[model samples]
Target: MDTMRDRLAPVLTRLLDGDPRVAVLLAEIGADGFTEAGRRHPDRVINVGIREQLLVGAAAGLALTGLRPVVHTFASFLVERPFEQVKLDLGHQGVGAVLVSAAASYDWPAGGYTHMAPGDVALLGTLDGWTVHVPGHPDEAETLLRHAVAAGDDKVYVRLSLLSNGDALPVDGARFRTVREGRAGVVVAVGPTLDDVLTATQGLDVTVLYATTVRPFDAAAVRRAAGAGRADVVLVEPYLAGTSTAAVNDALTGVPHRVLGLGVGRRELRRYGTAAEHTAAHGLDPRSLRERIGGFLGAAARH
Candidate 1:
């Protein structure tokens, strides 16, 4: 099981060599990974020395010059801290850039809340024309990276976290794929949440839909999978809870159904521990996730 970063980090070299318009904007992260690329393409590979604002701003400026800029940093710095720069420099200016994030959600809980960005996807969703991808595996992550660059100025957000599934699936860009089929209900897993979602719905009669692209929401595919839009829909995300609630609500509008959302909780745990510890604290571990699904669908066994 290759990690998302392991898969994506190499794409920088390919992009630099293949396309002159491609640029990699870094905010003091991934320096070691892109050292060779920076040396080879001195003009395109830029590190702004921990300044998140300048990272986004420079990417936007590069885009203004008709260059395709790929910005990389931790989730919090990439989205939360320099958000205004992202909004105005990129979104407001109507210029396009690809924002790639690692250490997502609580993947770096030891780094504390300052590094935690459960709201990155939700916040970026507010911006228009963003093709958000949360690939469960590295192959998928690499594919999305290539897709974003080939798109030519299409705004893309690639969320690379420490968590990942066991296997890889061929991604069709913005489409969602069925992990398993059933009739009782539908359990939709976004990004790395697939493994836990699969384990939680083992005995339940529900369809599991895996999605790497969440911003586009893929409502049509989701509705079609729902089979008349009646099966209970459960969205299991690795980020903020209820982050996709509105999109889901609107997607299934006028169709009778029940929805359940599970993810990082709203309240801050304020504890230092491993990512798994934070996950369990927020009721996102396998056992807690199973209980939420079981109770909602009325499974006979508690576990």
Candidate 2:
């Protein structure tokens, strides 16, 4: 399959060629020189220093002028700094703009807190009229990006992590997949964590669900997966606990749901390491997740 960057480059290039009114706002260092080498129409690339707020504001302005703007930046700065701009400027006006965030979670190593952002899943999910997508693999990313651009929603946040060379999951459009459909238990995995979930529950007799769209989660499908019997559901996310996991649990009501959150706890994370190392340290690694799932299953079997 093609790399995430390769898949996106062509689609973005085609968008530029087809739409003269479409503009792309990318960070100075984050563009990775794709704009220069790629086929971008003349003057369509807008570089807004390192100011995250300015990036969103400029995109909002561009949207007001009937030009579709795609804002690209690190997840940390894109969501935190320009949150108000996203909420008021783009969200309030219902201006169609796509926020492309990279290095979601601790994808980058040694970049420290300034670069690592695991809370975007939760933060972006809170906005009204804003769709949140966390693609697990390159193929899914490509398909989702194309769909997001074509859908032309007012506000949309697409979370992307470093493309892992591992096998890509089969994703068709916006539909989520059920790895194992059983009435015993449900394990909902977002993004690449689907791999981890499969690995962790090797011999377990439980169902695994892969969800790409966190916001406006498929309630009907989830209810169907839960079945009418008493089932135990668990959510696995590469973000802090309070956001995605809590929200999913609350949505599942009556059903016994548990959240397996990765990254820092309630306190701030002060240590610096690679995404894998950080995740391992915080009990988000495959081994940790396996143990957690085993425990959940063991307890469930008791009663």
Candidate 3:
């Protein structure tokens, strides 16, 4: 159980240690910390200036020359600015590289709208042959990153949250954890909101599902958890209530499924706040989730 920092540093070291041709691209700001790590394996690290579009485009070009490239940048710039490059140069051209997105979702409080790109999932989902992964903790992050490196996918986007000090939840990229399996109701959570989901289920006969992968969801696992009889399923997220929840609900057609999509609303968000604040303001806090789950269960019981 290595700390996330420990896990990530060594994984980067190994990637650098193994391939001299492989380049590690970092944002100007991220360079400070990553550069120190790169000192242990200096030749592999390259700073791509503040140009995220060029960074991704360059990575795609380098991949064409038989060199594996790992690009790192804020999620916002990576997804928005170089969207054309991502879809055309990387995805359409069938380039093999990993786009390591830092500060995913509400993790970047200091980074306002320009810096915050919570919709990376929605953006990447549209690209063909692009593998999208959002790791809940550092351990899983390391594993998934390594897999992306070796994997032969044309394009891969990994949305990484800040390092969590808490214990890592049991995740295997396929079977999500069902913390509690009760006949009463079902609560499904996606990435890092497990705490809120758990809190929302107190004193209720609820089955909780931790959905780690928003794309390529496990339909069988979801259907089993949703239960065929009379259980109610609620999908929870920390982003806009669209793709992930909608996809799951669509998959479980004819089943009783409800989505509680929680994220930054369409309205212009003004204040800069931490992930906790954003979740709370968006009705994703534990108390709010608890109330909603209780009401849903109560209604289900009556029917």
Candidate 4:
């Protein structure tokens, strides 16, 4: 199976070649993997060498000089460590950049708590006008990355995860697409969690919605898909728990509704294991999701 890295390499090459003003900054994470690109575009592709803060600051500086900077690193390093630089240097300065993060959430659980960053998306939520994309598959990642780069002067975050869905949905911008219809309620699957969501809701009767873009939240689409009044909303995000709860709540303001947010657990597991094992531990596996969903749907029906 092709990973997001596989798709991103060629797209980066194309992006660097097409746009003279486009540049790439790395914090020593994927320097070796991007050898070919670096060799081709010596001036544009720069390795900042293990300094996350400086990586973002430099990118912001480049953006100020009319260069479109695409910063790359792990989620923890990209958003968590140098967040101040992202907030002050990039956001405060009003310079736009496309931040691409790998090893999403627990994709590298073996890397332990230091590498895991379920809170990355939530932290970015604190900032203003930042577009976030959590692609389910490599195709979706490619589409989102290319689109983000093409969108001039827009601050964007593209999250890349190891887990992939079976099918590729068309890459529409920041809108929730209806996957299935049912009277029970709505199951909104975000990013890589689509496969688990589909499996969890397989036999159940509920409307399913899919979205790669979570920052915008697509409230109108949620309202439309949820039918007329308040409907059961189960948000299955790939990031921290309850990241999109506020947006969903604001969308259906007048209607009284309840939400069950599911994602990586807030508490640190602090154990070394495979990603699958970590997923089960956090009750995010297909079986666990099914049980939680069944209970939520059942309770909703009772009320």
Candidate 5:
């Protein structure tokens, strides 16, 4: 039951050792995991001691010098805190880097709202030309990480989560993988929500799409799944609710379609609880999802 973060150190260490152009910038979070990598390549592995802005700025600087930079931190600090830098230093400057994030949504509920960033993905949607990878399993994370590193001056965000599916499905890091096929509608599961989505949609007639790469919004895949008719799409993301709803709407443009976006709710829960509790509170648990999905698709579901 190793989380994606558990796989980061080794996979990144291998990447750093094998490629001379790969550099990592950290903001004191997960810096301990890269001790060996820092020792092996002092100039490449850098920790800016809690300066999240500097972490992104330095990564952008490295990218400008023809180096591929992998920046790591919690979702909030990585994307939200230094967002201005992410927008200007990287996007505006036209530099490319790999932004890897941990602590998906409310993974560490005790850490409170400051550490939780359900809006990270939605916030990044404002920028252009960015590739977003939300890996459901550790294996998928490694695969997407490698792809991001070798993207050749393309902006990529590899969002690693403490949550994961029971197994790793085949992910090309470019398109969505169809886990199951049906005709009634399509349930697009982004990253770790695949397991719950599978469970929630059982005994129901609907297509299940597993999306590791979300930014490009695999429109063609959904179009293919929905076929040449009125499409019903349910986007289950692990971030802010309706984060991908607009994208789904845009994808189904000109075709009659209805979309239901489910994920962490906008209402802030003021209690400190386990991640499981948070999931249920947000109506993202399997049972709640079953009811919602069944109601939306107008199909009776069995647990």
Candidate 6:
């Protein structure tokens, strides 16, 4: 099974060929993947060396010239290291660009903490008018990538990951799709966490929602999924814990709702272990999630 990162080059290549306005900017990361595209459209496909700041600034500059720039790099360098450029270059200028990131969370554990960006989504949440998409499967990633590029000068962020679900859910990259329906609670799974969430919530009486596009956070869908009684929501994100807690709370305004935000913890583990080890340490594995989700919902039911 190909990872989301594996799909980036082919999809972007197709987009670049089809759309004249589409441009790709890289920071020496994943430059080899675009060799053919760069040869075909040298002006559109640019590699600005190892400078992460230039990657974003150049994308914004291209957007300024009426071209839709799709920027690529690791999550940490693309979003965290050059965050100021993301904010001012694109946000402040009111220009649009597609910032597609690779290596979600602890995808490259051996690369150290600098490569791991568990807070990328949360950090981007601080900015306004940005659409965030965390696709669970490569198919979903391709769908969201095309959606972002064709969005007509809208600021978009497409998060790619080495982690993927067993199967792809039919997602249009706009709204949340209902995977399962129940009455006890609602489990909103983001990106690669969907498979784990499904495993954890199996046989539990709860509505499971698959969200690829998180930013315009489907508040109405969440409200409807919560049913007419007490809302017990467990947001299982692949990023920082409680990243979407505020959005869930606001969705249930004036209503009784209990939200349990389960994700990558703030404590950084210094050991260079495998990504699976990191997932277990963060308490985001299927076993840990099952225990936590059950306890949270069971406790709410008792009250």
Q: Which stretches of candidate 5 lie over 4 Å from their true place?
A: 299-303
Clashing pairs in 1: none
Between candidates 3 and 6, name the one with more favorable TM-score. Answer: 6
Provide the clash count, candidate 5.
0
Whichever of 1 and 5 has more lDDT, that candidate is 5
- Poorest stretch of ten by lDDT in candidate 6: 294-303
The candidate, 1 or 2, that scores higher on TM-score is 1
TM-score-wise, the better of 4 and 6 is 6
Worst 10 residues of 2 by lDDT: 259-268
Model 5 pairs whose backbones collide: none
Q: lDDT at 51 for candidate 2?
A: 85
Cα shift from native, residue 241, model 1 (Å): 0.4
Per-prediction count of colliding residue pairs? 0, 0, 0, 0, 0, 0
lDDT of 4: 0.88
Residue 213 of model 1: what lDDT? 91
In the range 194-300, model 1's lDDT, one tens digit per residue, is 88888877877778899999978999877887787465788899999999878787888888888888888889878768998988888887899888888897762
What order do candidates take by lDDT, descending?
A: 6, 5, 4, 1, 2, 3
**Cα TM-score per model:** 0.96, 0.89, 0.87, 0.97, 0.97, 0.98
- Write candidate 3's Cα lDDT for 262-295 as tens digits: 5446554678767777777767788988887777
Candidate with the larger TM-score of 1 and 4 = 4
Off by over 4 Å in 6: 299-303
Looking at candidate 5, the ten consecutive residues that score lowest on lDDT are 294-303
lDDT of 5 at 118: 95
Best by lDDT: 6
Better model by TM-score, 2 or 5? 5
